[model samples]
Target: MARLKIADNLDGEPQTAEELAVKTHTNAPLLFRLLRALAGLGLVRADEEKRFHLTPLGRTMRTKGDGAFGDFMEMFLGDQFLPWTKYVDAIRTGKTQFDQLYGVPYYEHLKKNPDERGRFVNGLKQMTKIFNANITDYYDFTPFKHIVDIAGSDGTFLINILKNVPHARGTVFDEEPSIEAAKKNVLDYPNVKDRLDFVAGSFFTDPIPAGGDCYTMKSALDFEDELAIQILKNIRNKMKSGTKFLVIQTVVPDTDEFHIGKLFDQYLFMLTGGKERTKAEAEHVLRGTGFELNRIIPTTYPLWDILEATAV
Candidate 1:
C-alpha cells in the first residue's frame, strides 16, 4: 500500500479507475479489480458513474488526515509484520521472533535500516501528537521552571508544554537521529525555539540531562521488567530530591477483563522481549528504582495514563 500509495492517491479526490491508475501509474484493469474488492469491503464507495471515493473507514487509511492511520499501517504492515511469520518459532523457543527474523534485536535492526527507522518513528509521531494535544490540558506544568523530556522524539511533548505554559523552558533528550529530526521540527516554531534545545545521547547509557525540575518520558517503558527498572533507575540517579518524573504509557490493569494493552502486550511479545505492564507493575518499577509514586492519572484516551512520581 505504501509502495503505490494506493490509499494516499485515492484521497486526492474521487476518481474513476482509469484516472486512479493513470495518476498512480498502475495497470488500469488490475487496479479496478482491486478497487472492486475494496469497495465490497466498504473501504471505498463507488458512484453509479464508476467514480470511487474514500469511505469513512478508508479516510483513516489516508496519509494526511487527522484520522490517518497510515503511519501505523506502514510500520505494522512492513517490518513489524515480518516477525509474525516466525511467531510460532517465538512461542516454541521463548524468544523474540523479530531477532529470529532479522538476526538482530528490534532496536538494532532499525539502527541499521534508516528507511525502516523513519516509518517506525512516524508511527510514534502519530501517537505522541494525540498524547501531547491532550496532555497540557489535563496536567499542570506551570509550577515547573524547566522541563526535560527523556527520549522525546521530535520534541512534540515539550513543545506543546512550552507553548501552553509560557514561563516554562524545555529540553528534549533523545538519540542522535531523533535529535536531528527534532531540530528540523523546531524550525517550524521560531517563536518558541528559544525555550527548546535538543540533547543527543542514550537514556540508558548517558547521564540524564540535569537541572530540570520536571522530567517526562512518554511511551518509553514498554520493556521487560528488568530493563524497565534499569531505565527508571538511570533517570532517578539524575533527579534531585523532589524532582517530578512523569511516565506516560498504555497502563494495563491487573484483570482478566478485555483491554487494548493485552493486545499490545501480545504484539510486543512477538516483536521484542518487552511487554506492557499493569498500573501495579508500573508502580513497582518506580519504587524499585528509587522514586516515590505520586499517582496514576488516566486520560480520556483509553489505555494511556501518566504515572506521576518523585525522586526520593
Candidate 2:
C-alpha cells in the first residue's frame, strides 16, 4: 500500500482498481486483487461496483503528514525484515545475523547505502512520533539547563525536549547523516531552533561534549553489553560529578504478561546483538560505570522508560 501510494491516492474517496492503477501506475488486474486483499484486512472497503474506499485505519499508511507510518512499515517490512530470516541461526550462535548476512553492522550498512539510510532515518523519525509522545509531560526535564543527547538520531527527541523545557538548551551528538537530518528538522521548530546544536561524531570514539547537567541516550544503548558499558564509561569520564544520565529505553519484565520490550529484545539481538534489559539487568550495567541507578520512570509510551542515574 505504501509503495503503490494506495492510501494517498484513495484520499477517502471510492475508486475502481483501474483508477487506482492509473494513479499508482500498476496493473489493473493485479491492483484489484491487491485491493481485495486490503479490504479483507480492513484497510479498504470494496463496494458492489468493486470500487475501493480507503478506511481510516488505512489512512495511517499515507507516506507523509500527521500520524503516518508508511515509511516505518516500509522500513521494518523491507531491509530490516531480512535479519529476522536468520533468527534460528542467531539463536544457535548468539550472534547478530544481520552482521553475518551483510558483512557489517546495521549502521555501517546504512552508511554505505544512501537509499536504505534515508529510509531507516525517516522510519525512526516516524517512530519517534508514535513512541515519544508526551514524554516531557512524564519526565521533569526543566531542572537541567543543558541536555546532551548521545547518538541522538535526527534530533527529533532533543527538539521535543527543548520545546518543553524552554529554558534548556540541547546538543545532539550523532553521526554526520543524523546531524544533517537534525539541521533540517530543527528548522520546523523555530522556538527551539536557536537553542539546539548538532555535533557530528560517533559516541564510541568521539569525546562527549561537556557542560550538560543531564545526558540522554534514547534508543541508543540497545547494543551488546560491552559496548553499552563502554558508552556509559565514556560519558562518566567526560561529565562532571552529580550530573544525570537518562537512559530512555524499554525494560523487559520478568512476568509472562505481554510487553512490547520482549518482542523488541529479539529484534535487537537479531540486528545488533543487543537485548532489551530488564530492570535488574539495566542496573547491573549502570553499576560500576561511574553512575548509580536512581530510578526508573515509566512514560505513557509502553516501549520507553527513563532510567535516571547520577554520576558519582
Candidate 3:
C-alpha cells in the first residue's frame, strides 16, 4: 500500500509496473499482483485503459509528503523492519532483538549512521504534527510565566504554543544538533524572540535551568527508563515544590486494537529499545521517580495523551 502511495503522486499520474517495481525494489509481476489485490480491496482503482490510480483510501495514504502515515510507514519499513524476524527470540529472551540483528544497539546505530538519524528525525517531525494541534489547544499555557521544553527538537511544538498564548515565554532545551535546527525554526518568530531561549545540553547530564513554572518533555521519555527517571529527577530537584511537569506522550490503549499509538510502540521497541506505556504504567513510573501523577488528559487526537504530574 505504501509503495503504491509513493508511486501515485497527487497529480494522479500512474507509474508503470516496472517503474513502481524499480522504485520499491520489488519484482514487476509481484508488484502488479499486489496492486491487483489492493484494487480488489478498494485501496486502488484501475481505469478503463488499465492505468492504476488512487482510490479514496489510497489517496489518504499519499498524504502530501508531510503526512503522519508516510512518516509512520517510513520508520516501520526503514531500519525497524529488520528486527521483526527475531521478535520471537526477543520475546523469549526478554531482550531487544535490534541489537542482536544489528551489530549494536538501536541508538548507537542511529548515532553512527547519519542517514538513519536523518530518517528518524524526519519521521519524528511528520509524526509530531499528528498531535500538535491537540497539544496547543488542550493545555492552558497562560498561567505559566516561563516554560522549559526539555529535549524539544526544532522548537516546532513550543513555537506553536508561543504563537497561541501571547503571554507565555518558552525555553527550548535540546542537544546541540537539535538546538541548531531550532535556531532556524525560531527566526520568523521575532515577537517571541525575547521569550524564546535555546539551551543545548544533555538533560540527563546538565542542570535544568531554574525559574520556569512549567517543564515539559514532548515524547522525550520513551528512550531509557533509568535515564528518563534521572532527567525527571534532575528537573524535580531544580523546580519548586509545586511545579507542574507536563509529559506529552502517547498513552497506550488497553485493547489490542490497531491504533497508531500501538504501532508507534512497536517502532519504539524496535528502534530505541523503549516501550510506550499505558496510563497505569505511566503513573507507576512517575511515582517511582518521586512525581505524583495528577491527571491523564485525553487529547483531541487518538495518538496522544497529556499526563500532567507534580513533584511530591
What lDDT does model 3 reach? 0.76
lDDT string, candidate 3, 208-276, tens digits: 878889989877568668767777777788888788999988888798777788887776776657878
User: Which portions of model 1 miss their true places by more than 4 Å?
Assistant: 1-3
lDDT of 2 by residue, 51-148 (tens): 89988899889888888988878778656888888888888888888899889998789888988888887777787786565778778899999999
When sorted by lDDT, best at the front, the candidate numbers are: 2, 1, 3
Error of 1 at 118 (Å): 0.7
What TM-score, computed on C-alpha atoms, does each candidate reach? 0.95, 0.95, 0.85
Clash counts for the predictions, in order? 0, 0, 0
What pairs collide in candidate 1? none
Task: Let me know the TM-score candidate 3 reaches against the reference structure.
Answer: 0.85
Off by over 4 Å in 3: 1-10, 14-31, 63-68, 220-224, 253-267
How high is the lDDT of residue 235 in model 1?
90
- The TM-score of candidate 1 is 0.95
For each candidate, the alpha-carbon lDDT, in order, equals: 0.84, 0.86, 0.76
Candidate 1, residues 158-199: lDDT per residue as tens digits? 888888888889999999999988899888887679989888
Which regions of candidate 2 deviate over 4 angstroms?
A: none
Worst lDDT 10-window in candidate 1: 1-10
